[model samples]
Target: MKALLPTGDPREPVVLADVPEPTPRPDEALVKVEAFSVNRGETFKLEAPAPGDRPGKDVAGLVVQPAADGSGPNGIARVVGHPMAGGWAEYAAVPTDALAVLPDGVSALQAAALPLAGLTALRLLRTAGPVLGRRVLLTGASGGVGHYVTELAAAAGAEVTAVTRDAERGARLIELGAAAVVHDLADAPGPYDLVLESTGGPSLATALAKTARRGTLIWFGQASRRPATLDFFAFFDGPESAVIRHFHYLDADTSLGDDLAALVRLTAGGRLHPEIGRIADWADTATVLTDLRERRIRGKAVLTLA
Candidate 1:
């Protein structure tokens, strides 16, 4: 099997090489990977390559074999899965819990874009509790997770204020459901009832200060890669009762299959739109990774297996 492996080289971090095929466990299904999505976090991992580490986490494909436990979809069904690694290959062994059958009308490219970003947005919204008629602030509103968060929050009746430096991407967010778009975090309206902060650095401080009293602000990622420094005194000036919560998608209360099914249903019903910013052959994975790392690509990037 041909797989993209970490080369541990600065100039060529990942190289496609012949690797041994994966053997599925009793509870796992062997998927013939048709497509996969690139994530920003995976780009960071490529910075320090490991010999056998397969970096891909999101994959969509045909289930060639069912789990021996007789769980999950069967009979060569189209499915999307969240594998820990080894997805950027010809096949991957996906755990039954992390797999969901893709419904009719949902293309492989769209399903490939759903797992990480879609699940993250869905779970974060779950953590946000009821959003109806609330003021929501979403920073870094142009990436894969950002697009889902913007649409989901806005659809739930929250007046979403999406912050992104790119005006072009901001315009798309409005179409997705964002009520207002700001070029910077400082420009965002204050006292938001719910906040999703991804870009770290000063943005984190601004998000904290703008959170409404008793409001919840979930900090997920640091796309900026800069560490955030906060003055303990600054908290005193902001809302005294504001809550700062750290969120990870894997820590969600719901099962991955359940959440993925929800997302699939939304996509099938023409509700949740999977924003695919880039689509290309899997051979172009290296270039796509560079584009994502430099923030050149918006939304999710999917690569198809040839």
Candidate 2:
């Protein structure tokens, strides 16, 4: 099997090399990977793995070897969730419990894009509770997870207000079902019932101020690479009560089946379309990661296994 390995050297270490194909455990399935998406977490993982290791978690592929456990509740099947490594390759073995069956009409590329960002968006939205007929704000509404969050929130009947820095992208957010779009945080209308904060740092603080009294603010991503600091007095001592919440999608206890199903439906129905910015061959994994780290790419960048 050919897999991309991260060299510890920060300057130039990522390279594709032939490696041993992973053997599926009794509870795992061997998948011939068709496609995978590059994410910030994946980029970070590439810089550091267990000595010599592959780095990628999102994958969309066909199951060639089902786990010996069979297709029972705990049986191995076409796995889709997290993998220890080897996602950026032609083959990977993943736990059956982590997999979600790809819907009939969804393509491998779209499936590859779903597991992480879609799961994160679904979990964050659920944590925000029902948004039906409520005013919701989503910051960084143009990135992978942010785009999914926008669509999910809008589909739930929330009057979604998408926040982005690019005016052109803001227009696309409206087409994605955002009730409105703004180019800057300063331009965002105030007092939203729920604010999904993806761009942390100053943007978080600004979004926090715009939240309504007793509103819930969910902080999910730190795109700015800066830690978010909240004003203690502004939150705890304010006349109107507000809650600042931080969410990590991987911590959600529920299975991804429901969210994956919903995302599939939305995509199939044309209500959700993942904006694919770039598609590169598996051998170019390192270059893609470098671009992602430098914030030189847009939307979701997918690596296809040749």
Candidate 3:
């Protein structure tokens, strides 16, 4: 099997090599990986390289064998899930409990893109608010997680406000079900029922200010690579009080297959759109990683194992 690994040098973060095939554990199944998605975490991990360690987490492929304990559905099936470290490979050993069997309508590419970003969006929405029938605001509405958040929140019957730096993409977001899309937070009013904040720095402050009195704001990412400072008086002596919560998505804890299964069903039923912004052969893995790290790609970038 071929796997992507860190080179232990920040200047040269990743390298590809022939590695031994993974042996499945009792609760795990062997998957012949077809496609996988690149995430910001993979890019950030490149900063501190670890030699011989596989860096990816998301994969979608055909299950070659079932778990030894038969904990999940039986037989071979197309599945989407997270591998502890070896997802960026031709094969991976994934825990059966974390796997979601993809329906016939969902492609390997689409399934690969959903496990991380889709699950993160679902978990964040659940942690913050149901968002249904509420005034919801989502920042970074053009990124991988943002697109899912925008579409899913809207699908849940919420009045969704999507914020993106690219005003041109706002139209597509509205088509995804957001009530309106704006170029920045200033264009949106404060007191939203819930705010999903992805970009950090100034955007964090904006989300904090825009959250409705007693509304919930979930901050998950720091794409801006800057710090946000807050004013005590502005927060405490404000017209109303608000709660700002931080979020991090760990597939092991956050996903028990329910959310991914629902998302897979939504994709299969045509109610949810999968945003695969870029697709390339595994030979182009470095290029895809660089594009994602530079923020040049809009949504999910998938690498196919040929």
Candidate 4:
């Protein structure tokens, strides 16, 4: 099996290498990966994988070898979700509890996009509580997680204000049913009932000030890669009451499989859309990885296996 490898040099990072196939444990399922998507976290960590290590978390494919206990799908039942590692290869051995059986109408490309980013968005929105008839402020509204937040928030009937630095992405976000789209915090509507913030640092400060009295704010991603500093007095001066929450997705989480499955059903029903921006052959892994590292992709970039 051929999998993408990091060359350990920052100047020229990734290379495709022939790796041995994986073996499944009794509790795991061996999957023939049909497609996989690149996450920003993977793009940031381009260090060379140690021997027997493969990079990638989100993958969708057919379950070639089911768990011995009959806990996972057998035969050709399609599945999609997170893997501990080695998902970049032609096949992966994932724990049966980590995968969700994908629906008939959803393609492997779309399923591959759902695991990490989609789960983060779903969990954060749930943490923020109901937003059916309230103003919601979403920052970093362009990347993988941001795109899902935009669509899911809109589907929940929230009046969404999507904030993105890219004009093209801003336009596309509105098509996802955002009530309003803007480039910065200054341009968004004030006193939001709920804020789904991904851009930390100064953007978080702005989002805090824009939050309505007694509203909730969920900070999930640090895309800006800056330190977030807030003045204690200014932030809690009693003018507007705010509740802040921080969240990050964990791979060993047991509930993620169920969440990913629900997302797949929603997508197959046309209520959720996971856009695949750049589709490249798996042989061109370096190019797709380069585009993700350079922040050149507007939406999720999927690499297809031949």
For all predicted structures, in order, the TM-scores are 0.98, 0.91, 0.94, 0.93
Comparing 1 with 4 on lDDT, the higher-scoring candidate is 1
Model-by-model lDDT, in order?
0.91, 0.78, 0.82, 0.83
TM-score, cand. 4 vs. native: 0.93
Candidate 4 residue-wise lDDT at 78: 91
lDDT of prediction 1: 0.91
Ranking by lDDT: 1, 4, 3, 2
lDDT of 3 by residue, 1-306 (tens): 788877755455667898999999999988999999988777887887665568777899999989899876579888998776888888899988678998788999999898888888887877765666899888888888888988888888899988888865787898898898889788887578888887788878767888777888888888787898777566765426787788977623445577779889989999878888899997778778887888788889999998
Q: Give the number of colliding residue pairs in candidate 2.
A: 1
- Over the stretch 1-306, how does candidate 1's per-residue lDDT look in tens digits? 999887766466677999888899988999999999999988889898676688889999999999988988767899999999999999999999999999779999999999999999999999889999999999998999999998898899999999999999999999999999999799887898888999998889989999887888899999899999877777679767778899999997789989999999999998899999999999988888888888889999999998
Sliding window of 10 residues with minimal summed lDDT for model 1: 6-15
Candidate 3 Cα misplacement greater than 4 A, ranges: 8-12, 236-239, 251-255
Cα-based lDDT at residue 149, candidate 3: 87
How many backbone overlaps does candidate 1 show? 0
- Give the per-residue lDDT digits (tens) of candidate 2, residues 168-283: 77887787789999888889877798888888878888888888889888888888878877777776443158888879886766755555666667777777788777889877
Q: What lDDT is reached at residue 177 by model 3?
A: 88
How far is each candidate from the true structure, as Cα RMSD in Å? 1.0, 2.6, 1.9, 2.0
